[model samples]
Every structure is written in C-alpha cells, then in structure tokens.
Target: MHSRSERELGSGFPAVTTPLHALTLRAAANSIRAGELSSEAYTRALLERIAATDANVQAWAYLDPEGALAAAREADAERRAGAPVGPLAGIGIGVKDIVATLDQPTQLGSPIYTGARPAYDANCIERLRQAGGFVLGKTVTTEFAFIHPGKTRNPWRAGHTPGGSSSGSAAAVALGQVPAAIGTQTNGSLIRPAAYCGVVAFKPTLDALPFQGVNVFSPTLDTLGVLARSVADCALLASCLADPGGIPGDVEPIGRAPRLALLAAFPWVATSIEQEWAMHAALATLRDSGAVVTPVELAEAWHDAQRVHRMIMLYEGAQQMRDLQAREREQLSAKLNAALDEGREFGDGAYHAALARRDILIAAITEWLAPFDAIVAPPASASAPADLTHTGDPSCCTLWSLLGFPAVSIPIAVADNGLPLGLQLAATAGADERLLAVAQWCEERLAFKGLL
Candidate 1:
C-alpha cells in the first residue's frame, strides 16, 4: 500500500491521507468529481501500489504507467476546467488481457498473440472510458480464456491459483491494486477467479453489456463481466456499461429482503464438508435477517446440464479456433488442443442436440427462479486450491454459464485452510438490475468482510 503525499486539502472534498487505491470504484469517482482528489494523484498512487505489491501477486500482464498517468491528468484537467464529467470519472479499472484494448497488448494468455494490440477499443473498454474510468493496465488471463492457468497467484494465499481467465482482474481488486476491473466469463472465468481470490464478481445477463471486441469462446455462453471489492462497485460498472445515463449515484437499497432459494448441492455432485458448513452459515445469516430461504433442485430433465454445457462449449470453441489449430498447433497448449479435438470430433448433430437440451434447461431454471428473488449456491467446491498448475474445477459454474443468466459471486467466508470462499447468487436471465439489488442486500447482511 502506498501513502498519499502531503498536499493541501481542497475546499469541499476532504483530502484523503490514507491509501487512495483502496477506495471502491464509486467512491473514487465521487471523490474525484468533488475536487477532493486529483485523478492523476489517484492513478499515481495505484501505480505505486502496483509497483510495490504486484511482484508477489503477479496479476498484471501489461502496464503502462506513463499512458495511465497521462489519461488521469487529462481527467483532472477536464474536471478543473468545468467540462462535462461522467459518473466514473477518475475511477481506475483493470482490463482483462483477453479483451481488446487500443493501448495495452491483448496477448490472450498465450504466445499466439504475444504483442497483438487491437486497433479499436473493445465495446466495453470504449464505454468505460466514456464513463470517465481509466484503464490502469491489462490483467493476466488463462490461455484463450480456457482452463490453462496464468502466472497470477492468489493474493490471500501464495502459491495457489487465483482461478482462471479473470485471475489478474480478481487478484488486482482483492489486493487493492485497482478499485475495479473488467473480466470475461465463458465457463466461470469471472466468477471462479473472484471466488478463489476473494472479490465480488458480476456476470450480467448475456449481451447485457458489450463483447464486440472480446475473443469468442462459445458465443452462446460468452459474457463480459466485472470484479471489485463490493457489490455496489459491480453494480456501478454494470449500470454505466448498460446505460451510462442510468448509472445510480450511490448504492441504493433494494427496499426489501430477497426471497432466495438455497441450492445445497449440484445435482451431479456434493459439496465438501467445509463448503457445506460455509454455505449453511451463509443461509443462516440470511434467515436471521428475515429473508425467506427455500431449498430447491432441478429434476432429471437437468441431470445432464453440466455434460451438455461442456458439449456446447467444446463444439463452439473448436469451430471458433479451427483456423488457429490448423496453422499453429504447436503454439496451442495440449489441454486446449485436446478440448478442440474433442469439439471437432463431436458431431454436428450432437452439438445441435446439446443446444436444444440447453434451451429446455433454461426454461426449467427460469420457472424455478420465478418464485424467488434469486438463487444462492456455492461458487466452487472449495477455496483456492494449493496447486498453481490447475485452476480448480468448473463444475459449479458450468450450469449457470450454460443458462446465460446473470450471476454474482460474493465472498462470504473462509475455509479452514485460510483460502477464501464465495457465495454464488444468480437470477433469471434479463433480471440483472434486480439481481444486483438483491446481491447488494445479501452482501451487506453476510457481513463477511475480506481479510486482504
């Protein structure tokens, strides 16, 4: 953590002597707009913090302090000159390497595009800038947003995987290196990392945000998501990206406790003893808060959801990366190549069947969600595992990704081993705003403050 330099406290906005990088996205923006803090100073503080701590976390893939500082200076100048300011003005955000950025190189966590820099900003990045947020750097990601792990390590526990794809984004936010960051989820890329790294991860309803410049990995399930320290920060990013005009000025109350359904276990698997205890504790907290918690499960019709999800992901992923496999087979990881091979072998008929089966399950889950504000489940079977080679299993996240529903993972507790545990809350597709509202309510009630 970096300390703020001695400076005169401005008139209205009080000067912040504490570390500036620890503030949430909304708070930083508010402070910057009030002239209490300079965006350049804020960004510089974060850059210094990154310099200090990133060596241990290894979360960043590409960083350009000069470019980031320049952008922050412009924001400060614009604010001082009485120019129109967006809600996210001066807020710092980290961009996942898989997402295209005009400034940072998008390496896709592989040497295939080691120095590839896109000419146009990804739609998400474009809107983030328009909202006055500046990209602090590009965070590391899994190879092609798949199971391949990156160099990023869990900030809470060293030598453990921070989970995939969104590894850097989640680690950066959890360690207070950045207030918020953009992450993409195809198969738990966003939620898994958030769960393992102990941060808030939000994957809105499919297509609710932008993915125009993101690398395609199962278009049916691909989603642009975010990670931050708090639910309000996630909501702020979601609101700004969905409709900059509709961004809430602050974290507003949802007015009532959400009627949530507690799913104790996946239909195909069971939770570990520690996971069970953590989950039950979360449910108990909600019940004590006067919220209705119901137990539910998907019947035989959904028994194959996880299997079918993999079918579709593999089929679509293989088709998407066909050209790359044909030309650069050596560059691809064995794991990824094996997946692609399986996908190619999966018949077109099977792929279509899987898609149809997925649609049926979506309808079933939608009906299940109709009677509740949201559904609560475990984000993973355990906390960040001790191994760095494997980025944990994706079974817990497979069904949600297949459904393309809005999902939020909030860190609710810690395991006996000291790794962080996340509670997964999801709503029916297109219920993103309500989901965020309910999620914020649950987040406050759980009161499981992070250690980092």
Candidate 2:
C-alpha cells in the first residue's frame, strides 16, 4: 500500500497549461525565491505530469512521490525560515539508475541487480540535494550502462528508440516529465540520446564531476552529463553540480565572426542523405550569419577511435562486472554477457597500448581544433529516432569523449519525418566554459534567424 501523502502528492497538482515546457533549474529557483510559486507546488506539478505520461514512455525506474514532495516541502520551509537557497533550489531532477541513490533502488537497468539499493547516494545526487534539489525519481538506463536497450521508448514516436544508456533521462526531458535529468556516457550515451530525442545535452570535460558511488562501466571514459531544453539550462545544471565558480574568464565571444571547422568525413560511420542535408543546412546558417566555415578532413588515426573506445570499454567493463558474471551469469542479459566474453580476449598489453594511443589521438584532435572556436559536425547518422532494439551509433561522439573534450548537442533542425536533428559543437579539452559561451551565442543567433 502507498502512503496517503504519496497518493496526495501524485494526485493533488494540476496539469501544465502551456505548450512550452522548458523549465530550467535556474528559473525554478527564481520562481521560488520570488514567491511566484511554491517549491512543493512546482514539484507536485512535475509529479502529476510524470504520472500522466510516463506509463507510455516508461522513462522512470523508481519514483518516490512521497519523498520528492517531502523534500520540496523542506525546501519551502527553509525559505520561510530565511535560509539561503542554492542555484538549483526546489527543482526536480531525475537520477540515472546507474548512479546510486540511498533512497531508491539502483538497478543499473539489469535484472540481476533487481531491488539493489546502496547505502550512500551518488556524489552528484548528494551535491544536488545539498543545492536544494528534489530527487524526482530514477530514470531508465541501459543494462550496466552498455548497449543493452531499456524499456523506454521515444516520446516523439512510440516504437522508435530514445537512445541508450541514458535513454530515460533523454526521453523524460523531451516529453517534459522533468525539466532536466542526470546522464552518464562512456561511449556516446549522453550526446547520442540527446540528439535522438531533440534536446540539449552537455558532456563536460572528462572528470569534471566526481563519480563516486556511481556504477562503473568504463572508468577512463565514463563521464557525467546533463540533458535539458536549452544550452543555458544545461550550463546552469552543470555549474550547480560541479560548483565551478565565476564561469571561467577565458570564454571570449567571437567579436567579428567565428571560424568553424566542419568534419566532412568520418571513417567509422557514414552519414545518411538526410543527415548530410541537415549538416549542410546548419553550416549554411552559420555561414550566412557572417561566420567562416571550412571543411576539414580528420587524420586517419581518428578512424580507429571507435575500435579503441570499444576495446577499453570491454576490458574495463569485464573487470567491473567480474563479480556479477561469477554470481549471476545466467541472470545477465545476452548483450552484457557477450560484451564480457569479448572483453576476456584482450591482454593487458593491448589495453595499455589503447590508452597510450588514446592520449596521442587527443593531442592530434586538440591541435586540429586550435585555430577554430569549435568544430561543427553531424551529431548522429540519422536526424530522428531509430528502432528501439539499439541506440544509434556513438561513433560521431567517440573521438571527442576519448579526447576528454567538451561537447554539446544543439537541436537545430527537424527532419522531414517531423523529428529533430542536432548540430554538435566540440572544443578543446578543459575549455568547457568557452565552448558553452560560444554555443549559447550561436544558439541565440540561429534561433533569431528561425534556423533552430
């Protein structure tokens, strides 16, 4: 039986009346501060929305309506008591199940780990709670944050995929179940899902946020990121989670115009005709806005990044799940079991060599991006969501993730099928603030010109 408070929380709030449902963490905090809305009220509304739509989308793994409302009420009481509120005060955040939570079951999208709960919240979740955020629920993730798809479906079209690993986080944000959600990426989990679902996603430089308590898939490549409605929203959530002060001063605006390097060819993955047109259209918009765009060919070394990512992932994944494989081999999904089998073949020498090569590739990519503010490229092979059995290719995102570069996916165009297309922009390693500033500037310009 559910608690009366929980049932009340789920049923008490009214539906959102407006069509535009882009609620930012900053905006929610501001509204709370201004007394325009109560934290409890806002959280209740989001819970109601999730109750209405999440059944079909299957975006949540575990929802705690009672806990969320209790947290919201606590935040409101803090404000009434004249306590200072953080930037994310009163906002509801969906935690990826791969990231542990003391209050909810952390299943990591695996049946073998069913009903598992950790004693401590993940580092990022703890930070969000400290900043006065309400944990709305746990979002669905692929099995062990690998290739095994979850039950989540795209909100735009029911049968297609919403992308994986971070599937539910992307779908919830896209369908307005929650304003923003936490996601992780070892390969293309974050950016690929964001692109497929038509939302803004940001993958900060590697190790930007601490990953303590989160389930490890690939230690070196795993990164925490966020999905939201706008670039500014993504930045704000990142800032709160990371608590980086004063927005680094190096992010300079492109005074006259910007120079963008466009990758015309990718050896590992080929763009479809629709994707090609989308890329060209986005490039044309940038050029028409008085920017210089040039087609650049990547070095042959980049062609091997996908394979390198796979090797490192399999090696590390096998190590992470060794205990599980030993204890619950039959309970594991076929995709996960296959990955473990493949990982067992690689020797330590091959793994170390792959790491060394990754560093070299990062240097090469950084040098290539030195002359430009950012690189403009297609985010995925297709403009819209594909079949639910597999997440779209992360090949477009693998090199950038391996290099530890800051990457952002901006929703720029809609495909003929009425689904969204994303334009990805990447910057040099540790230049995330600069990359975001440029992205915000470009997003605004494009939106004004009706190109976004």
Scored by TM-score, the top model is 1
Tens digits of lDDT, candidate 1, 245-340: 343435567798889998878876667888889889988988999889999876776789988989999999999999999999999999999999
User: How many angstroms is residue 40 displaced in model 2 relative to the true structure, after the best TM-score fit?
Assistant: 1.0
Model 1: CA > 4 A from native: 5-17, 243-251
Candidate 2 per-residue C-alpha lDDT over 1-452 given as tens digits, one digit per residue, 9 for 90 to 100? 33221312234443343322345555667767776567887787777777877787899989889898898898999989988877787788988999888888999898877899898888888888877786789999998898889999888777778887899999998877788899998888889888888888989998887788888988989999888877888877777778456233233454666778988657888888887887787778878888798889887757788888889989998988888898999988888899998998899999999999898888888887899988888778885455878877888888787877889988777778867778888899887887888777678676521111
User: Per-prediction count of colliding residue pairs?
Assistant: 0, 0
**C-alpha lDDT (0 to 100) for residue 162 of candidate 2:** 86
After superposition, candidate 2 runs with Cα above 4 Å error: 1-22, 246-256, 448-452
- Model-by-model lDDT, in order? 0.86, 0.80
* Per-model TM-score on C-alpha atoms: 0.96, 0.92
